[model samples]
Target: MDLQAVVDSLPRYGEPLLTTIVVTVASAAFALVVAFALGLMTSSKHLAIRTPARAFVEFIRGSSAVVQLFWFAFAMPVLLGIQFDYLIAAGIIALGLNYGAYSSEVVRGAIAAVPKGQLEAATALNLTPLQKMRLVVLPQAWPEMIPSLCAFAIMLLKASALVSIIGVMDITALAGLIGSQAGQDRLVHYSVVLVMYFILAWLIWTGMRALERKAKRGLGVDVKPVKGRLAPEVAAGGVR
Candidate 1:
């Protein structure tokens, strides 16, 4: 690969990279909030409250995210007679709904993983249902939910690339533009964008790993330290 050629190709992609990052971060935050709300609603004891939330989650999960994106971009305005920026609306609706469904499952699993004994103990203490969830269950569940949440966030980030289909000019779109401009150097141009995405994904993974370690520590879970082993002489000295 001609390294200089790839370097030269990067400027054309800068805007697209920025657009992708912004959409990913914004959409993931929105999705997290939506997921938490809907997930809780789905777990509600009242059939009226739970049924719709459960159905929504199931429907979103069963559908194709790309198809949803296309619907939002093309069909929504016609159906509702309201216009929105294609990229912004797509980011908000597609990612928020798609990841929200996945997050509902994560939340449900986390809540289920909370031991029945804990709920009983809370009830024995005369705690309200809300109190039990707030004080006893969610604290435990949030940490457990982190790994899954991180995975969902990564998926959302990659899926944000699909916004390019509607001419959103996200990272993938920028790569396509660079490929067109570079002609025979298309391979080098696209390679740079690929490497950039790989690096971004790696950084996200590393950050999530650090967050998981911190959460484990906060929860008083034993995390084995990576360090030098204690010598037998030192152990004997301490025992003495």
Candidate 2:
């Protein structure tokens, strides 16, 4: 293995790595918002509200993500006559819309998992529909949603590699470029790239695990304490 080639390429990855991280984070944020909006709409009792949201979720989820990215990058400019000056923005939207559809199912299922008794109690207490959802249903549902959302978010981070096709200059794009130039050292270069992606995915998983623990704790569920991290209970009480 030509270790020097990998070493020399490391510095070159800085900008491309940043691009990948930015796209993943922006796409995940957008997907989270869309997931909640569509999930809540689909969970509604009114057919009028639920139908369109369901259709949208199915359509986006059914279609190929690459096709969706291409449409946003190429077709959208011509059809909508609104060209995105930053191609990265278009890539982010496509990833968001695609994964948002998948993640919405997580939200819908979690909301449905809330016990019927909770709804009954809310109604008996004369809580408005909105109040019942806000105070009773969602708190219970949110903890369930986090694990699936984390999975989908990690999937989105991996899928962000597709944006390289649209010239966003992400990690995969640079890795491919470097590999082609390395000839005999191609294996070493690609192996390093694989490790880079794994590290990124692991970071996302760790962060999401922390969030999952926090969400479960809100419901008074016993969560194994995180090592080397101060608990909220301890933090609030301050030092003895």
Candidate 3:
């Protein structure tokens, strides 16, 4: 195999790889904001608030992300009468909205799973609704939600690949470009690209693990299961 050729060709793709990372990171951050906002909105006492939140979550989840990306890139500019740098915005919004729909459930589930006694205690303490959520409920739920959020972040990273189709020149795009110019076969180019993806994924996994441990530092002496696919444990520092 022309391994040396593949290795030598990699440096040229660095900028696009960075583009891919930027898209994924930016999307993940935006998705977290959307997920938490919509998730909490679902719990509102008023139907007006809850219904729309539920509808939006379901609507975004039900739709195809690729189609959404296309729309953001191709259709939104015309419909909204606003121009866009679709190359960037399309990937970010489409990935964020799509995954945010799924991750919202994680946020909701974590909040819902908090024991009833905790809520009652807050009520007994005369905590305001905002105060209770901010200080009492969320503190307990945050650890549980981290694993799921990280899972979505990983999924978002993979999904960001679609952005390349809209001319983002990300991994697949750069790989193909380099392969063509260097006269390398698919086996050589794609194999190298796959390794690059794994490296990025590993870095994210390790960082998330560290954050998980730090988040649980004050939970308690006993370990509690973090929800989602990761299934890690955090000590019950205090919240339980």
TM for every model, in the order presented, reads 0.87, 0.90, 0.89
lDDT of 1 by residue, 1-240 (tens): 456766766677777788878887888888888888887998888999999999888889899888888788888779986567555666567888889888988888898899999999999999998899999998888888888998888888888888888779887777766666633366665677778778877877888888877877877975665478785668688756
Candidate 1 ranges with C-alpha deviation above 4 Å: 1-5, 182-184, 226-240
lDDT of all predictions: 0.81, 0.89, 0.85
Candidate 3, 24: how far from true, in Å? 0.8
Note the clash tally of each candidate: 0, 0, 7
RMSD of each: 3.8, 6.2, 5.8
Runs off by more than 4 Å, candidate 3:
1-4, 221-240
Candidate number of the best TM-score: 2
lDDT by residue for model 3 over 196-236, one digit each (tens)?
Answer: 88888888888887777777876762344545634233343
On the 0 to 100 scale, the lDDT of residue 133 in model 3 is 97
Who is ahead in TM-score, 2 or 3? 2
Clashing residue pairs, backbone N/CA/C < 3 A, model 3: 218-237, 219-236, 219-237, 219-238, 220-236, 220-237, 220-238
